[model samples]
Target: MFEELRIPTLWITKVRGENTVEPTRLAPLMQYIVDKTDKDTAVIIEGIEYLILENGFETVFKFLTNLKDNLLAKMRC
Candidate 1:
């Protein structure tokens, strides 16, 4: 699906392989993208249940909250 849309995708997984990001590292990765991209960016997260299973609801919630805050901060600039 991402290939058809021509959108680059990164896998959030514990598996050690190419184009894979661990759940713990997702926040920093997203922050980097938000910081570097000049154009509007659309982020589609598909595996909330999986992330919750791996990192609990609170952790995922904090991650999302931080991402939202970062995006908003960027927008204000």
Candidate 2:
């Protein structure tokens, strides 16, 4: 569906291997996106269930909390 629309996209995965980001690296990756995003930017985070299964809910929760904090901080500025 996304491919047919010609919108640029990235698929982050651990299994099936190509174009994958390590599960452990999600936080830093999100931080990078937050740092680089412009006013028109949009981000889609897929696979939360998978991430939680891979990294544990506690770690995923912390990552999301930090990411939210960072975004909120940026928004305030």
Candidate 3:
């Protein structure tokens, strides 16, 4: 569906998952968004449930908190 909109997208997945071009490491994923996104950027993150399942709620919460902080700062610009 996203592809139909012609927007550039990145897909992350676990090491054993198929059809995934990128690894699902939290840091790298956040870094990629930080590097690519701006105040006007709209992002679609599709796999929070999967992330929590794989890495637990606490870890995912921290990751999301950091990512939110970063994006919020950017939005202030």
Candidate 4:
């Protein structure tokens, strides 16, 4: 649905439930989505380090960054 719906979405897979995704796997997934689309996406994340990522997420928030960067670059120069 996400590939065509154009809305940002996430699919959760369980560990020991046929497939297991590490909680840490989420980081690169988030980065990949950002790189692929411009829309804001929310993930229903549950992890031990979840609370610690609030500030860190922003540092890697480059999804649709070209749009942001382009606009900022124009405004600055």
Model 2 vs. true fold: TM: 0.68
lDDT of each: 0.76, 0.72, 0.77, 0.44
Ranking by TM-score: 1, 3, 2, 4
- Write model 2 residue lDDT over 1-77, tens digit each, in one string: 87697644546565545445677687656766687565566667788887798889998898888877887778777
Listed in order, each prediction's TM-score against the native is: 0.75, 0.68, 0.75, 0.28
Which ten-residue region of model 3 has the weakest summed lDDT?
15-24
Number of colliding residue pairs in each model: 0, 0, 0, 1
Q: What does the lDDT read for residue 72 in candidate 1?
A: 79
- Candidate 1: tens digits of C-alpha lDDT, residues 1-77: 77897767778888978767887786666766576454477777888998888889998888888878887787778
Q: Model 4, 1-77: lDDT tens per residue? A: 65597654443343433224333455555455445443343434444244235335543344234445544454454
Ranking by lDDT: 3, 1, 2, 4
- Residue-level lDDT of model 3, residues 1-38, one tens digit each, is 76797665767664544334343478978887887787
Error of 4 at 25 (Å): 1.3
